[model samples]
Target: MKNIQRLEMETKGIALSQQELIIYLQENGLQPHEEYNAQSPSAKKAIYQTALSTLESVANNPEMMRNVKMDDMTVSEFHENLTDRIDQLEKKIRGMRTDANQSDFFMLFN
Candidate 1:
């Protein structure tokens, strides 16, 4: 299964935000599902199921609750984190565009 598709399915099941899903995929070294071909349907299904199960388990985990104390975060801290995340996302988008342009250039030149 492609990593992105698996992550998408898992994120849907767990109700995770895009940022959280991206972070989880990166942490697990999983690529987006589109990176995989359709020849291995069974493998893709298995990966999707596994990821969904794991996400559900983690969403219900008490340990995760203990680690992120919402009450402890100040408004300013939350705002700062949101701004930082937005900046990071903007950077990633720019990088993706650059990569796409490079690939296009190579295809044309090579």
Candidate 2:
């Protein structure tokens, strides 16, 4: 949740409270008592990957791309924004994997 919120805020300037996050997550079957451990790299990666997949779906939708108006955003502008965001998320996920693997590879060299 922290990872998702941080990236969203940094990339899109959108801020969400914990309460709001929990409410929507509940709709997806997430329990309130459930929490993610900061030490779990796989858990964080899975969440990021899921977010990336969802954003990609909307960004790649041809039918939904025509004449769309989201607040003050036009279709082209929205597409452009999504494209930038997708690039950033992909880079972040790749960096996470690379960093993790590099540390593990250090033991092999030793």
Which candidate has the top score in TM-score? 2
Model 1: per-residue Cα lDDT at residue 92: 46
For residue 93, give model 1's deviation from the true position in Å. 33
**Candidate 1 structure quality by residue, lDDT tens digits, 61-92:** 65653454467785456445544544554454
If candidate 1 were superposed on the true structure by all CA atoms, what would the RMSD be? 11.5
The per-prediction CA RMSD against the true structure, in angstroms, equals 11.5, 6.3
Model 1 CA deviation exceeding 4 Å by range:
38-110
- Indicate the TM-score of model 1: 0.32
TM-score of each: 0.32, 0.56
- Candidate 2 local lDDT, 50-81, one digit each (tens): 55655665676757666455788887897898
Each candidate's clash count: 4, 0
Per-candidate Cα lDDT values, in order, are: 0.48, 0.58
